[model samples]
Structures are given as structure tokens and as C-alpha cells.
Target: MNRFLRTLCVLVMLAVVAPALAATDVEAVKQRVAKVDVLRGEFTQEKQVAGFKNPLRSQGRFVLAQDHGVIWTTLKPFPSEVVVTRDRILSRQSDGSSRVELDGRQQPAMRSVNAIMFALMSGDAQALSAQFTVKVEVLPGNGWKMQLTPRSAMLGKVFAQLTLSGDRYVREVQINEANQDVTRIQFAGMSDTPTTLSTDEGRRFE
Candidate 1:
């Protein structure tokens, strides 16, 4: 697959797993993520594909708005942006040219992907449980980890497993694909302050 398609697949994998956690632990995570109406963070992603001597790496900043959806901007390796909402997926190049845009009304898969992204990021247990069989582990210091196995045979053909770890927000996401490729993403410098998105920043979603 090309770089952009590969990256897109990785994004979809962000919510690929839904494991079982204690009810209290699950509620705690849901509550923690619920406090944020908007979230901004920096991320580093590494993909280890079989037969590649070195892993592909990229760095980016992301914005998640409760109603506006997600704006992910990649700054390293190459500049690109992906804006995903309930109704559409917009991809743009560094030159401010549109690369691809998918409307959910025309493409039902886009809607499904968008929903999965939101559910995964927001820690919505009900939505996740609909897709994957999940197992969650409580860690020391109020942190938690989760492992997800695909409940659908179709999903199992594409992914082997997915794991997520975090405290108040998702700190890491790991995807093990059926092809033996693995992608790991680490998020840092997260902020959920009301001022996190300025007027200019907010316009990116438009």
C-alpha cells in the first residue's frame, strides 16, 4: 500500500480493539475522557512492516472536538492532513490541495470508520463492545491497559489484535495486523483546556 493509504489504515486501527475491563475501571476511563470537550495533542507513530530493515516514523498534531470531529496534521516525513467527521473524510496535501474526500452519505464505510474513531477516542464502551471482545487490565497509579480481539471474521482477516494504554487520555495505541506488520502510536503533550483551539485553529475543521 502507498504511504497515505497505509496511514489511513493505521488511523482506523486506533479503535480496532475492545477488551473486557472491570465495570468500575471502564467507568473510570469513560469519566476521565468525558471531561474533555476538546483535546489537542502531539503524536509519534512508528510502523514496523515485515521485510523492512527500519520502521517508518512520523510525527503529528491532532485536534479532537466534541462536535466538530478530528483534525490530524502530520508535520514530519511529509506534510499532510486528514479531517474526519461523522459525515465526511477530507485529506489535504502540503500545498493545500485536496487529495481525497469521502462523503459518508455516498460511502457508508466512511461513516463506520468515523464512528469507530470517535468511539475509540472517547472511551465509549458500548460502541466498542459492539465491534470487539475486550479485556482490560488496571495498572498502578490509576492507569489502565486494554487488549482487543476482533469479533467479526472479516476484521480478523485484517488485524490480529490491538492494544491501548492510557491514564486520563489515550497515551498509546498498538496494532498487530494479520500481515505481521505492527504500528505503534504514542501521544504526548495533551491538553483539553477550553482555549486549546483558537479561532484560526477551529477553522481547520471547516
Candidate 2:
């Protein structure tokens, strides 16, 4: 389930609201998402496997630094953290010990996944456009919706479709896997204040 949790898009703290969209397009949604330098927030995730009747659930918090990378710490059911950067991915336990590490330079798939993770967390429409066939819709209540289909061979292996729905800030991300599994991630008690990383966060980036 932890490996499947990698597909979750966590930490969407959009405190700065934008004007209602005059146009319903990826560009418009991109403009609405808060462009903060640092964002910290809590998240809840649900993983529904095809054969299982009950979904597996977990909640966690994440720190996203646009200039650096993202640190995701899962707190329930298990305690571990996955840190994502441009060049590599580092997964560790709550004890600050390494569990898994991958270099983008060594694995082609890792490079693609890293790019997509940053793109999704930061609401980078341009980056997403480059990789997925994107469709956008204007919800009746003023929220926006998006459907993304993988355009790459590597992505097609893990994901079938990705749905994003939110207003001002993305509120939920639903992942549809190729193997009939689904994962939904929602943020709670989210805020975009304190636009600076803490000392421990800074050290983790090293």
C-alpha cells in the first residue's frame, strides 16, 4: 500500500485566492493556484484496492519548498517519510533513517516520476501539459475540474487517469491506477502562512 501511496498528491495549501476564472482552461486554473515559496499542511489519503471491500486509509503532513523539494511524512498505520527532489527520491522512516533512495540519473522512470510529482504539487500546468493530455471544465459552483491522461509510455504503466477538482486551491486529487485501484487524497486544516522553512526542514533538504 505504501508503494501505491506514491501516487498520492498531498499538500495543497492555497490561501491566496484569485478572481473567478474568466476562462476555463488549464492556464486559468494555473493562475488561480497560490504560488507560494513554502507551503506546509496536513493530508488524509484513502487507498481502495479492487479486490478488497474496505479501502486502506492513512493521513500525513507535507512540506513543499518550490525552490528546493518536498518532504512527505506519513503518521498513521505506519510512520515514514518520502522526500522528493529534482535529481532523486529519498524514503525514510520516522526515525530519520534512510529506507529507499533512487537517483534520477540512474533510472529513467524515476526521472519522469520526479518531474510529475513537482508538477502536480506545485500546480504547474505547463509541466503537466508537456506530459499529459489535459482536459478542463468549469464546475457549476465556481470550482474547476481536470482530467489528465498519460502521454508517456512510462506513466501509462502506473496511472490510467488523474482527476483534479478544486477552487482557488486544489482540494482533492483522485488517482486512477491501471490495475483497477484508486487513491484519493484530501487536505485538512491547511494554511499557507509562515512562508519559510524551519531549521529542521532546511537540514532535511541537505
**Reference-based lDDT, each prediction:** 0.69, 0.66
Q: Against the hidden true structure, what lDDT does model 2 obtain?
A: 0.66
71-166 per-residue lDDT for model 1 (tens digits): 788899999888777787778896677678767788655466557656665657567677788777778787878787877664565568988888
Instruction: Summing lDDT over every window of 10 consecutive residues in candidate 1, give the lowest-scoring window.
Output: 15-24
- Model 1: what TM-score? 0.82
Encode model 2's per-residue lDDT on 1-206: one tens digit a residue: 23433443222211111211212245666565566677677778888989999999988887877778877888998998877788877777889765777677886766767777666555565666667887887776657877778898777777788787777656777878877888788866666678888899988877
TM-score of every candidate relative to the true structure: 0.82, 0.82
Evaluate residue 176 in candidate 1 and report its C-alpha lDDT on the 0 to 100 scale: 89
On the 0 to 100 scale, the lDDT of residue 80 in model 2 is 85
Local error of candidate 1 at residue 116 (angstroms): 2.7
Per-residue lDDT for 30 in model 1?
Answer: 50
lDDT score, residue 194, model 2?
82
